[model samples]
Target: MKRITVIGSGYVGTAVACLLSTKNMVAVIDTDKEIIHKLSKQISHLDDPQIKKYLKKNKNNLKFSTELTSAISKTDLYILCLPTDFLVSKNEFDTKNLKSVISELTELDPKVPILIKSTVPMHFTDEMNKEFNRDDIVFSPEFLREGQALYDSFYPSRIIFGSKKPSLATKIASIFKEAAKNSPQVLFSSAAESESIKLFSNSYLAMRVAFFNELDSLCLSKSFDAKKIIEGVCSDARIGNEYNNPSFGFGGYCLPKDTKQLISQFKDIPNSLITSVIQSNEKRKKYISNKIIEKKPKNVGIYRLQMKEGSDNFKESSVINIIKKIKNHKIPIIIYEPLLRKQTFLNSKVMTNFTEFAASASIILANRYNEELNPYLEKTFTRDIFQEN
Candidate 1:
């Protein structure tokens, strides 16, 4: 078994570490002590059920630590899954964390291969290789959902590796294929093309979401059935149904930031479609908030802050933007997020008690539907038609 160390314990890192540990001696390194502590006890920091299951079953093969030096000895492979959040002022993803990790890893072990699974800008792998003066850096973008990250890794739709060395790339692909449950299609390409693949793949999904959301907005304005219209449109075999669900907007860690980064890469190129996708998301949120304000309810209740049903991520969630818009209209708001520990969020009262929360709000806004809200369906406002996150 290869000795592998996965840096960063976020969703991507955690999922990859768990999957690789099934057949390898895996060391998971994170800067946060609490996250490392949880994993050391065979507990997953994320809300993914598959991750938790892996931790329970594969605990013997995995080790968790806050420092990389402890696990750097004789490590055969180093995978980086650090964060690359979009910086609005710079109009690109902030790669400081990714670079820091790479710098440290190269210094600690110059000969070991480095695999980057983070979402980066187009041609970023080339830039990093040139900057570090190393050709062993490979970019393998992860196409994973927030809550189902581990499951997706276990049965990936496809596997891709972007590298300068064909032999190294092939070896890395083999490692992933061995860990995966199914024999997924594998592709090897230039580092730049692989980087582009990651950005373009997410940009396309964001566009689809924007399309369906705009359609939903039009239906709301014209008093038509969005569900039936979507059903008819997706029934066509060419379109095939996926990612057509309407919500407050496409707001998660990946879609919003990745779409913006993709646009930045279009620097001098004439493009209206991608620009429209970003605008459409903002417009959809405005439309949703306006619909809520039109009710002029005394107390508006937010059912959850998560972007999806099974996720615990609140970063860039569209619901937060909706709350901000409604707050501007001086609407009294109350949030019912069981995950929230504080008494207030964004200056609004936070209630963990569903009974009190349901009784208080004249209208409760939910981005996704929940069975718990069935009794208060009349007072709840949601765009979840199929309810299948």
Candidate 2:
């Protein structure tokens, strides 16, 4: 019965708090009133139904608070889950929140080990350790999907700890493994290596996405079956399967920023292909939008604004770029996303029914294909190389 306080109530933070609450005394903290309020009800803001179900089954151990200082009081472990949004002006991650939160926690409790699950710049933890004069700090990167945070936590593929101390690393890994996996991996390293692990992992996934998207662009241009080509290629053991679906571009929170951050780290260093990966994603979106324009469609309907399927996040989403490019040609656009109950998205009228959305638009652009748009397949414009929903 350890008292664990988790800061930041975003997707990753909420998932961590929910998962830890299964057997420990967990207090979730966030500055956002709505998020704290929702967690007080033992509910998840991720829009995932599993959270509600989990909370119903395990009700007594979880709580929410907005007061950071008080939440850290008397807690055995402090988890930092703040957002490190990619700042376009700086061309680097805005880690201001992470730095501030860590400083506050150290001032409040100097001895408490702070596990940072937030995505940060490479070697940030090592720098922080030097500045703070403490060895209790650690880094553990999270691979959470927008709406599937808890589900992924319950069955994480791997767990890596960025701790210099072997014992501390083992302690953190054991807890997570006990909650989720049978024999979860527990890799230990310096702060710099841990930070690189997260960035490199996401960048690789982005590269995979960019690769297939460019293939889709080539297929569309030459009038070939892009799906068959991908199936044949991915069938090879070297490529395997997963994340093979092509879309507007890779535009979730982690991929876009992480890829650019990796490239940014190479600003002074000699590099060609890493820089090209970032540029390629931007070019891919522009190409897809240009293809949509070439169809001579006056009205375009976006099936969903989210970056991927089963995700509630649209931050830095590629679909937004496509919309802007298409709208530049003065084409009217509509949307059909059940998650968006509002009348419009960025001024485009929201069409609730698939049939209505399909009927009104000359061309419907879908990032991921679905059977709901089956009847209008001929009129649908998509770069979904894997035809995966």
Candidate 3:
């Protein structure tokens, strides 16, 4: 196995770092000194219990640090798993991290094949190659849930590389393939085309979510059972019945930004719904907040701010947006997040004790339903159609 280095050390980077450590000597380079210190001790800053276990088991091969020189000097392959957040106002993804990592990698070592695992603006790879004067860099997107990052790494549905050098791409793909639990789809392409593939893929999933959400919205408006309609529609084999669950909106690290980035790419193009889908998500968040507000509650409790179960991410969690919505409306907010060790969330009281939160809340707004709040089930307001999200 070849030596591997992962930059960023967030969810994606951490997952990739741990997974590669199973077969290769892996060192994660992060600017976050605290995170580096934790990883250095074979401990994960993440709340996931499984993550810590993996860190313990793979302590021999896994190492982490804040030094870029040591990282670049140690590994021939560097994975740039930096943040590529959506620029909401700009309607594009901020590829500043990817750009900076590529430049840094070149300054460190020109021969290292850096695989960009961060999502980017379409044609980013094309422009980057021209700017940096390197053909060794490649774009390989990651598809991982926040909480199940490592598990997904071991069982990735696909491993795609955006490199014209099919032979070299195959070598990179082989690294992930050996570590993967199942057969992974390894496809090669021009960096520009691959970047488009990642954006368009997420956009399509976002569109699917929006489609089902509108269906739920229509059902709610007409007092029709959403479960019945969804069941009937998904009964068709053509639909395949995945990503069909409805929610306040699609808000995570990827979908929300990816859809907007793709829409921005269509600047001169004639499109209405593509743009409307983005608008609809915002409208949906507002609409849900309004619906919860009509209850005339005194103190509202937020039960689990996670985007979905088994996911530790809340980067653009819809529930946090709900908190922002109710803050100025005179209703005091308390949050019950098992993942949090803080006394508060943003500014709202963080109730580690469910009993206190449950007793004080006039109503609880959960983006996704959880049975843990069953003691105050009557006070809960959620649109969990299938109770899956």
Candidate 4:
């Protein structure tokens, strides 16, 4: 079995480390003691139930540690899954975490291949290789949903490796293929092309979301049944029924940032549709905010701060922007998010009791509909026509 060291214990890192551990001697390294401690006890730090189940059954093949130096000894391969959030000012991803880990790993001068599973800008792998005078770095992007990370890893839509060495790429691909339950299509390409693939793929998904949201906006303006229209359009078979459900806009860890980063990459390249996708999401959010404002409610209750069900992340959530717009109109806001421990969020009062939260607001805004909100459907505002994410 190949000795693998996976850096970081976040969602991507945890899922990948677990997947690789199925056939390899894998050590999952993280700086957080709490995360390492939990992993040692076969507990997951993330919200994915599949990961929790996998960890319980696969603990024998995995090693959890906070010390990177100890974990790296005699490692056959290293996979980096560090965060690289997009920076609006620079119009690029802030890859400081990846750079720091790479610098430390290269300083050790280990003769092992390094796989980057983190999302990065175009030519990032080549730039790192040239800077460090190493040719062992490879870029492999991940396409995992927040709460379904492990399940997706077990049955990935595709597996791709971007490297200069064909033999090394093949070896790595074989390892991942062994872990997956299905035979996913595997592609090998240049590092830059792989990076572009990730950005373009996410941007395209965002475009689809925007297209439907704009359609919903038009339907709302004319009192047309968006559900019927969407159903009819998707029946063409080419359109397909997946990802057709509309929401406030496309917002999560990936789509918003990736689409914006893709737009930045097109600064010199001629493109109108790419930029419009970002604008369209913004327009959809404003349209939603105005609809809420038109009701003139005394207090607007936000059902959840999460982007979707079973997810704890609210960063870049569409409702956040909608909240900011609603606040400008001087309307009091009450948020009913159990995830928030604080009494206040975004300068709005947070209510823990669902009944009290529901009773206090004149109207509730839900981006994604839930069964609990069925009792208050008349006062609820949402665009979740399909009731699925």
Global CA lDDT computed for model 3 = 0.83
Model 4 alpha-carbon miss at residue 54, Å: 1.4
- Compared with the true structure, all predictions reach lDDT values of 0.93, 0.83, 0.83, 0.91
Residue pair clashes in candidate 3: none
Using TM-score as the measure, what is the rank order of every candidate, best first?
1, 4, 2, 3
Q: In model 2, what are the clashing residue pairs, if there are any?
A: none
What is the per-residue lDDT of model 1 for residues 63-166, given as tens digits with 9 covering 90 to 100?
Answer: 99998899877699999999999999899999988988888887888889999999999888888889989999999989989889988999999999999999
**Residues 161-215 of candidate 3: C-alpha lDDT, one tens digit per residue:** 8876777777888999988888877777877788888888888888888888888
Per-candidate TM-scores read 0.99, 0.95, 0.95, 0.97
Judge candidate 2 at residue 247 and give its lDDT.
Answer: 84
* Most TM-score-accurate candidate: 1
Global Cα RMSD, each model: 0.9, 1.6, 1.8, 1.2
Which segments of model 4 are wrong by more than 4 Å? none
Q: Write the per-residue lDDT of candidate 4 for residues 146-226, one digit (tens) a residue.
A: 878998998999999999988888999999999999999999999999999999999999999999999999999999999
- Over 93-130, each residue of candidate 2 has an lDDT whose tens digit, in order, gives 99888888888888988888889999889888887887
lDDT of 1 at 137: 95
Position 15, candidate 2: lDDT: 82
True-structure Cα RMSD, model 4: 1.2
